[model samples]
Target: MPCPPAVRPGTPQWARCRAMYTSEETAALLGFSDGGVDEVLINEAHWTMRNLLLEQLDERAQMLTGRHKSLSMVEGVQHDDVDGIAFIGYHAGAGMEGVLAHTYLANSITGVWVNDVRASEGLLNSHVVAEYGVPVVLVTGDDLACEDALGYAPGALKVAVKDHVSRYAAVCRTPTRTAADIRAAAREAAALATRHQPVRGGPFTVELEFDAEHLAMASTVVPGVRRSGERKVAYTSETMYEGIRTFKAVTTIASAAVEEQYG
Candidate 1:
């Protein structure tokens, strides 16, 4: 997940900027408050789930930082009181064209389909939160990611921080510029956080295509995952909550199966 000067962990231009992105977004949404909103929960969803720099955040907000969260990226959404959620720094699904795009396993997974739909992390997580009546209120990422969100969170405000040029390259905007755009959009997004009825959009099937054949066979060790092709595995669950869990298990298994250098 660390790509040196271009996308390394501490560089402000790459990974560190996401902390600023999330903080500014939080500040913007809360700035609109008239005592209507009280708390802001920022969850770390990036690699290791510890990428966000806590000191950069406003005092009014708290972050969920750690790994092995019960719900993973959408961990905080399980509570009935959560009205809305946002997908920030998300990219296109695996096999799609977007900056640093990949599904859960990053490389082993070449693509994922949720109930016959090509699904990004944003799309998959959106379905998971829908079970709890939390709407996706805003999404911020590269241009392709914004476009990807259109299918899963159509009404949610979208802010593209950069234009995708390739998987590792983008026509990026300065943080100063993008922050302003995100701040404004998030302020507006705060109004759309109202909760709705819980959605039971499932009896879901998840299909994953891997880059290697061995990864496919390895995934089958996870219960319910079966080989669907030479390099693909499929699983079904009654709800997206279960579906996402199974998907995580499959990816973890596939990750372990990948051979170094030759993979």
Candidate 2:
């Protein structure tokens, strides 16, 4: 997952500027091979979901690239054999300070809460994978993102590639330094990959706060979602699988309703 420039004017800039970062991160993860790990599936979860450079990855791993995935960010976790998952190049949630931070909708979403707890994409996806009995073994990101992971996957190994100064600025480590650290951590994290009984931590409640009132109003178009406040909508589901689906639907519908100039 590449971190797009905060003020890039077009896709070309993003492609030229940010794509290499994610590739380097992906390469660092290849060190997991030393821990008796057989395969690695890189799910493209960023904007457009096609940021990772395929040729840059180690040949031993296969990547899942594109969009319209059933599980979205944690797309491959539905498999019964997946013992662990990792959050690579993730950022803090919307309303938090980290580079290119947001939930599903980059600008419209203000906050997301799961079971009355503030959640990032990591937390929400962590709950989703839990239902499938897969542990989140490692998380790599900026300092704040690693701190955020502590709330959901406390026992998982964490690597901070940068230190957040603001949403756009970060004190970054050079690729050589970060890659060495990430590879070593991934090797250690591999030993933590152990599946457990599926967690039925539901019925789950999800609440989303939007940056605009119109976005909240638009979210109600998703059947179960209703306006919970002037700029908030909430929904509940019997399981997190259902919960994430509804959340995706709500973000989709709301994004469509955004007014280009005013939003």
Best by lDDT: 2
- Candidate 2 residue pairs that clash: none
Tens-place lDDT digits, model 2, residues 62-165 = 88989899999998889787888888888889888787678877778889998889889999999999999999999989999999999999999999989998
Q: Estimate each model's TM-score.
A: 0.92, 0.93
The TM-score of candidate 2 is 0.93
lDDT of each: 0.82, 0.84
lDDT of 1 by residue, 1-263 (tens): 33434345566675655656566555454643532567778887776776766777777777899988878999979878788787777789898999888887667788999888999999999999999999998888999999999999999999998999988778988777876777777778878889999999989989999988998998899988898999999998999999988888888888877787662
- Please give the TM-score that candidate 1 achieves against the real structure: 0.92
In model 1, which regions exceed 4 Å deviation? 1-36, 261-263
Error of 1 at 155 (Å): 0.5
